[model samples]
Target: MQLLLPSDVVRKMRKHMFRAQRREIGGMIMGEQIADQQFRILDFSVDATSGTRSKFVRDAEQHDLVLKEFFERTGKEYHRFNYLGEWHTHPGFSVDPSLQDIYAMQDLVDGTGGVDFAVLLISRLRWFWQYDCSASLFLRDHQPVRVNIKREDPNAKTEGEL
Candidate 1:
């Protein structure tokens, strides 16, 4: 299946993705809801490889924990919230799943519902022929699905505190 993304959201994703690349850290986000899709991005998180986090970072290990917790927490946040997928950054102008990425995708599928989720990859910069920060989806059947990445502003206020 193909994913459709708004032009503006793609632009914003590129901006943050580059920031992560420069910091040598991985970026994460909640992919916006598609027009008629039944799923939504519950929350987003990032693990940077620069500054304090970079000193001793293990994204692969840490990501497992993060994903686990997120799944548990979001399951309670809303009855419909669930682990949709994952997004990471690639320090390049073109964002494509490398061999390692593909392996990771397979691992995620093996561990979870697989293609029922998505793994978004972003580039450090935009290229005329590359996807700066784009979303790719996978199916439990090991089919590759494309999702249109969208940009969304984080909520600046907290619940009941706003």
Candidate 2:
């Protein structure tokens, strides 16, 4: 299924990935959409101190703190933004949601009503994966619909802009 994200948001995500590559590290952000489906990216956060080998550590207390602070600071930026969820990366392979990922997803579901969001995974193979969706009883927990993407060709510029 095709994802219905705003064109501007997609562009910014692409741009962020490029920057992440330059620093040899992964990045993450939070976003939300109103009931009408209008998307707003609230804030971008990352553990820049960690690199490709960044451990997918499973620390409940630490995770809670991160999520809490994230919400407290930026939850009010949008008319309807909440702790919509997080994004992270993988050193290799497609950024498929792993088992640990599912657990984290479940935490979000239990903590916040039942909101869906995006998770981005950048691969060392020069590809990126985007997962977007919500949680449901019939669906697997933290299941993200993946969108494989390619960058705009610089040589084939669009319209009057670069």
Candidate 3:
């Protein structure tokens, strides 16, 4: 499996991850899945803070507002970029999904509409956010199976770069 993330998404995630080094932070991931094994991360939110040093939860209303506004502003034609998954940081420990984390993914997938599948992206970053997306086995085996993160060209801006 492969997960392609935009440089802008990487930049935003790293900013929040670096700023909140002592606690955990999280948000929703928006992207599209291509073929049997490719997920392209087009956008994400990072301001939702519901966590301690070891765990994090997303702010539902904040997430909803972001998603609603993003989709509304972008128009429905570009709505292929909907809810792809969740992304959070493990402040001090490994980025591997704990049993609890895997369980939570089930709820997210059930509630999220218009998607055949979802992913959980974890970052084991200290000063930088290293995004890692996993395959479906994450929920089955209760562990994270990482995929590739392909970046955009150095000179080119990400899809929605401003």
Candidate 4:
């Protein structure tokens, strides 16, 4: 399975990553899940919070409301969009999943019944979070799935450019 993230959304994440700098900041990815093979991330939510340098906990309090707002702002075609999953930054480190990361993914999957799939997007950034962030994706308990931010982005090049 693969995920498609649009260019604007990628840019937004990069901006957030830069602002967070050495701290962890995260949000939810909102989009439609197409069949069992492809998913599209059309929008996101960045809840303002003072995250720590090592961990980020999404503000679930604002998650649903933010999603509803996005759903209304977009064309009717995106009304069916649901929670795709979460994304966080791992500043100056590999995007590999830590043991805690794995458990958090598992916990999310378990908390939501019928969620056959879930996403955990980890991005490793350079100094000052400049340049395109190194990204890794995990779908459910599966191995890391490569993220194709967008075909149009010149910096979409990565290990798995699917």
Candidate 5:
């Protein structure tokens, strides 16, 4: 699957990551599925002060609120726009998913929550506004697969331009 990260979302994530300094921060990723096996990340919750230097546990309640708000704003469309997955900052560490990250995503998809698959995006600020990131798709009874991520062009007038 391919994940499209909009420039605005990237900027918001970078701002939160920089403000968090060495600590990790994260939240839910909400977006729309534009085509087969393609998803666009439109917005994400910013968790600025709820993590340590090496660990981040998102506030489920806060993220739920964000999701609900998105749903309301989108006219409660379930298939067109919904929860995609999660994202978190790794700060000084590599962007690769830790063992814990893998297990968490696996549990999420495999659980009775009705999610057949989920994406985990791990990222860290490299320097200035530059970032190193990895996106992995977790499926039930399957290994995590590396997902291709394309950054959306801010000036693009249409999806074809991306």
Candidate 6:
């Protein structure tokens, strides 16, 4: 499967990461599955104050509000638009999932009433407006798989943008 991240969303994430400085920050990723094997990241929540130098735990309540608003605005399309996964900054570290990160995602997908699969995006600011990121897909009872992430064309507009 392929994940498409819009430039605008990256810009917003960069700003949040930059502002957090050495600390890690993260939030929920909400988007749409545009094709059978393609997912487009439409929006995300930034929990700027939820992390420290080495760890970040998302504020689900805040993220839930964001997701609720998105669902309402999107006319509650559950099949197409829904919660995709989570993302967080690594800051002064490599953009690789820590063991804790891996376990968390695995538990999420393995839990009852949880999603069959989820994506985890680990990123760190490299320079101004530039970031190093790693994407992984976690599935229930399966090993994590690396996912290809592509940046959306700046000139192209998706339905969310319109």
- Return the TM-score for each candidate structure: 0.55, 0.46, 0.75, 0.75, 0.93, 0.92
**Deviation in Å, model 1, residue 84 alpha carbon:** 2.0
Clashing pairs in 2: none
lDDT of 6 by residue, 1-162 (tens): 888988788888998888999999998898998999799999988899879999999877888999999899788999999988999998888888999999899999998527999999998887755777889999899999999888886786643221
Question: C-alpha displacement of 160 in model 6, angstroms?
Answer: 20
Whole-model Cα lDDT of every candidate shown, in order: 0.50, 0.45, 0.67, 0.67, 0.88, 0.87
- State the lDDT of candidate 5 residue by residue for 66-100, as single tens digits: 98999999889989999899999888788889999
101: Cα error in model 4, Å: 1.4
Find the candidate with the highest TM-score and give its number.
5
What's the CA error at residue 150 for candidate 4, in Å? 5.7
Tens digits of per-residue lDDT for model 2, 1-162: 221244454455555555555333433345555446434444544554444444443333545566567667764555455443455555443445666665655555555535444444433325453422222121235454554232333354542211
Q: Of 2 and 6, which scores higher on TM-score?
A: 6
The residue ranges of model 2 lying beyond 4 angstroms of the native Cα positions read 1-28, 32-38, 51-54, 57-79, 111-162
Which one wins by lDDT: 1 or 6? 6
How many residue pairs clash per model?
9, 0, 0, 0, 0, 0
Model 6 residue runs over 4 Å out of place are: 156-162
After superposition, candidate 4 runs with Cα above 4 Å error: 34-36, 74-80, 112-114, 129-162
Candidate 4 per-residue C-alpha lDDT over 72-109 given as tens digits, one digit per residue, 9 for 90 to 100: 77654543577677778777566766778777776666
* Residue 137's lDDT in candidate 3: 26
Deviation from native of the Cα of residue 49 in model 3, angstroms: 3.6
Over 1-162, each residue of candidate 1 has an lDDT whose tens digit, in order, gives: 333343454455555555554443453444334345644454555665442311212355666676667657655453344455556555532466665566666666766534446565444454433344556766555766666544333452322110
